[model samples]
Target: MNLYKLGKFLCTVIFYPLYRIKVIGKENIPKDGPVIICSNHISNFDPPVVGITSDRNIYFMAKEELFKNKFFGGILKRVHAFPIKRGMRDRNALRQGLNVLKENHALGLFPEGTRQKNGEVGKGLAGAGFFALRSEATIVPCAIIGPYQKFKPLKVVYGEPIDMTSFRQEKASAQVVTDRIMEEIRQLHKNHR
Candidate 1:
């Protein structure tokens, strides 16, 4: 098995039982195609959880800081994560994301742009929206419910794909698709939790 799947398996063996993770609506994930899994970010733990949501190997757009440490950065790349400089339009990161979709791989993103430590959801950025509209990738909005407290019951609900084909003709902006994605994530939070 590849490092990504191997790491996932080890994480499942090690962390799953400890956190009592409950992954729901995984069936909502498309079995094949270029997919963008947009989710809420709360903690560092969210990345692993997001990767686990899809059966396929998912690439992540992580912050550039995560790659500063040589060892950890190497591990991140080995597991299919690329760095993005936050708060600016990092063209390199953008290209990396587009390439992932162009290759028809699953790309994971946090629409909020960064983590919300207060445990409350935040407004999403327009990045995910740009990706979906540009690549026409299937977007599966997901929510990570419950606290990340040790041994707590943390759940991940992968909701249905957000269809924007109808909105494409109206000259919808990236923010429009982003709002819809966040709405679906919030709905998952409401209905599942």
Candidate 2:
């Protein structure tokens, strides 16, 4: 198996029983075709747990700073994580994301753009909406419920695929679309932290 799948399998075997990770609404994930999985950022544990929400491998746009450490960066690369420079368009990252969608693969994005330290779902940045509108791929909203304390129960809730037809209109903007996506995420986790 490839590194990504192997690592995911290993994590699943270990994390599920250990942490009592609970997953809901996984049926919302498209069984095939391109998809963008938009989730609220909560912990460093977010990617691994959320990636396993579906059996398909998820390619993520990790921040560039995380790639600065050669050893850790190499592992991230091996596991299908690409670096994106935050606070800018980063055209190369955008193109790479589009290409992933073009290939009918699953792409994972944390719309909050970074991990939330306040333990509350925050506003999403424009990146997720930009890709959603550009690729018109299936957008599935997600929320991670956790204080991330070890050996504690954790949950990843997946919401229904967002309807983009209206948002596809000529007047829609990326930031506005992002706001809608974030709202869905917030509702999903409102009962949690």
Candidate 3:
């Protein structure tokens, strides 16, 4: 198996048993076609939590800083993650994301741009919306809640895909679209509470 699939298999075996990981609305995920897995940033475990809960292979936009170490960076790259510079548009990163979608693959990302340790929703950066618009991909709202501690319940909810085609026609601002996406995620969390 490829590195990404291998990692996913290992994580699924380990994470599901180690933690009480409850997944809901998985059927809402589109079985085919390019999709943006837009989610709220929680802890570092957010990616794997969302990744493992879904059947698709999710290519994540990991922060550039995490790739500073060559050894770790290699592993990240092998696992289908690419470096993204945070707090800026970073055109190259944007292009990379669009390319992933153009190939009809799932691109996983956090609209907030970074993790929020407190679990409260934060203002979303415009990157996610920008990618969805450029690639004409549907954005699937997902929410991950819980501590990554052994035996603690970790909840992951996959909401229905938020159509971006209408927004593209209206020429919606990336910031506005991103905020709307975040709101969808927030509502998902609220419903689960």
Highest-lDDT candidate: 2
lDDT string for model 1 (125-176, tens) is 9898889888868999989986887898888899888887876767689899
Better of 2 and 3 by TM-score: 3
What TM value does model 3 have?
0.96
lDDT against true structure, model 3: 0.87
Q: Arrange candidates, best TM-score first.
A: 3, 1, 2
Sum up the clashes in candidate 2.
0
RMSD values, in order shown: 1.2, 1.4, 1.1
Residue pairs with colliding backbones in model 2 are none
In terms of TM-score, which candidate is strongest? 3
Per-candidate count of clashing residue pairs (backbone under 3 Å): 0, 0, 0
- C-alpha lDDT score of every prediction, in listed order: 0.88, 0.89, 0.87
TM-score of 1: 0.96
| Model 2 alpha-carbon miss at residue 65, Å | 1.7
TM-score of 2: 0.95
Clashing pairs in 1: none
Question: In model 3, which regions exceed 4 Å deviation?
Answer: none
